[model samples]
Target: MTTPAQRQTALLVSVVGAVIVALDGTILLMAQPVMQRDLGASVAHIQWTSTGYLVAVAALLVIAGRLGDQYGHARLLFVGVLGFGAASAGIALAPSVGWVIVLRVVQGGFAAFLQPATLALLRLAYPADRLGKPIAIRTGAIAVAAGSGPLLGGVLVAHLGWRAVFWVNVPLAFVIAVLALTVRTPATQRGNSPRLNVTSAGLLAIALATLVHALADVPARGWTAAPTLLEFLAVIGVATMLTRHERRTTHPVVPPAVARSVPVTASMALLLVTTAGLFGALFRATFHLQDVLRLDPLDSGLRVLPLTVLMVLGSPAAVAAMRRYGARRTAIAGTVLVVVGIAGLSRLGPASTWMAMAAAFAAIGAGFATVMVTATGTVVGDAPPGYAGVVSGLKQTAMNIGPTFGIAVAAGATGTAASTMGSTLLILAALAALGLLPASRLPRRPARQEGEHDTTAALPAQAPTPQAAPARHTNS
Candidate 1:
């Protein structure tokens, strides 16, 4: 068993890993314009930097998760961190946009390995009863990283240059590596460890790539473009094949039995819908603030502060609510809050003030924090022992895909900023409403002892049974 000090050290390492993953997501967003100018990339090529990362992250998450289970999570995490740091360096020194995009994909693959293992490691490090506080702290770290990345990236890119944004990961990575080396955790090995389902992985990757391409293209090519149609078809076909393969395989990426569980399925579904809406809102709002509202990059990043603040404040409250009200109720409430928050955001117009924008973001941030914490708890809590890594990968897959779909749908819709916002929120509200049906199906608490005894006593009894005959004949 790990000592408390070791557990604490593990949590710190996990937190650092999470920060690095979150940082990568936003850092590139701010650096895109600079990279385009420096590398003479067309808009399409520059956009690939983000698109490739998302696709790779989504595709490899499950594989990485299983690798952690088969090998030691701590070992996999160390390797992932090292790989991610190296990829970041490559991105920093890339001679062309093409190489940068390639490295971003590699970085994302490493990120996939790191993310689920962090949570799995935490589960191992902490005891069940005491897990809430540490999970809350971890959630807070995620919120902080999410909120800070844009601003930090903006500063680095402005003064130091775009390459500096990637270079910043080096120090953080080194520190995290040192901390991770100190953590003590149990080793894991799968006897006759399953072979890599290379075919499934390839298919899924292709599907995600096509889907992202379709989404990205919607902004440039009208939705009716033939390429978009073909890409969509390709995604559907690949997904179907992948699903069939997983269902038939002895050692599937997502075991069919686990995926069919009510709690697991519900949690995954909730994550998918929530991610779609939240990421869509972020993408749209970012563009709206910068493009339509004409704010500078620094100001734009600062304007998003309210969401971060609310996320930080609300995460602990969410965990508390889960304990008191149960995961189902807490998740339902959170989804409602998200609906309200998105509605508030939909009200924004060209004339809206920064304060108004901030208020909307605050609602979204708090609402999402509630949903995220509860949903994660529900998923992890319901996962079977020895399968945490697989389930986590599934969850991450939903997370990655949802945002891509959301961005596609939102960007495809025709409207002014206000109208687009309204449409997107309406879609989010619909998805949130769908979450209520499943939320209602969570297992009910067992009856109290007195209630159970009283119920037993009320049952009708059969007639008294006669005693069995003795074996007296044999003695005679």
Candidate 2:
């Protein structure tokens, strides 16, 4: 059994790990232009740094999660945090842009290991019924990290230079490693030995990589472009192969049990569709604020501050609402708010006041936070402990793809920013409205029996802790 102290420590490590990763992602956006100039790299090369990281993380998440399930979440978290820090240090001291690209991808691989472990750690620490509050706190922490990223990046890049942005992660990683060591994760319950299907892993990786690449290419290369079409075809073909292969394999990448959970599947689908519409709307609004309203980047960021503020506030509130109302009602309410926010955004014109804009942004942020807390809690809470890592991996995968997919679709809408902005917002809002289908399918309340651990059907009731071994440290 996990003691309260250990649970608190787990929460701290989860928040810190999540913050650094989210911070790095957003802060890098600010430092990119500077890094390009400092490294004397072409625009495409600079863009690849971010793209490479995204692809690496997206492709390897499920595999990493499986490792966590097979080993221990705590063990995987330590290695992941340490490697992520080491990769950051390499990027900080890189002699060329090429090195930066390679290290970023390596860092992303570690990040994939880290992300799923965060949720899995929580799964081991907290019982299913008590998960919502912790998830709310985590959601709020992410909002804070994302909200502060640009400002923090601006400050770090302005004074310490672009390298300092990366250098900052080293200490944060160290702290997380220390905390990880202290937190005791419940031993994972597995049979004799779980065999990983290497061929299935490779196929899934290729399919996700191609899908992300195709979407990423959409802004620069139209849908009909040869490379884009070919990548999409590759994704379809590889996915087909993976499905057939998975059926025949005794040890599948995604277990059949996970695939059959209606609540879990619906939650993942809701997250993907909701984020696509929400983020797609945000992408278009960013351009409109700058191009049409002629607000400087700082001013535009300030106008959107309400969204961050509301998210931070709304997450905890969502937990209370969920307890009182239920996940389905809460999620549906949140979706309506998003639709209202989008409708409000569609009405904005050149003469719109900053308050009007901020109100709309706030609605979107608050609504999204509620959906996030509810959906994520549902996914993690409903998952069997044995499969926590992979379920978290699937959740993260949907999240990673959603924003990219949204931005690409938004970019594809025809006409100038001014002419197409309202129509695009409306289109996104309509798509978000469709999210109700999945939201309706969510559990009305916590589904697990009180005091019962959500364990897999085949897993043993009691797990044996592995023999104490020296912590394996990786050299940077």
**What are the lDDT scores of the predictions, listed in order?**
0.72, 0.83
Residue runs of model 1 more than 4 Å from their true location after superposition = 187-189, 192-196, 351-355, 415-420, 442-476
Residue 60 of model 1 has an lDDT of 78
lDDT tens readout by residue for model 2, 1-476: 68999889989988898899999988987799999999999998998898899898999898888888888788889999999999999999999999999999999999999999998888878776778778889999999999888888888999999999999999999999998899886665554336668999999989987898788778778778898888998899999999999999988888776777777888888888889898888888988988998887678778889999999999988888887778888889888888889889999999988889889989999999988998888888767677788889999999998888888778876533688999988988887888899999887653343454433334322222232111110000
TM-score of 2: 0.93
Number of the top-ranking candidate, with TM-score as the measure: 2
Tens-digit lDDT track for model 1 on 20-139?
888778777789998999999998898788878887787678888777767767777888888899999999999999999899989988888888888777756653334556667777
Best by lDDT: 2
Every model's TM-score: 0.87, 0.93
- RMSD per candidate (Å) reads 10.0, 5.3
* 367: Cα error in model 1, Å: 0.9
Compared with the true structure, the alpha-carbon lDDT of candidate 1 equals: 0.72
Count backbone clashes in candidate 2: 0
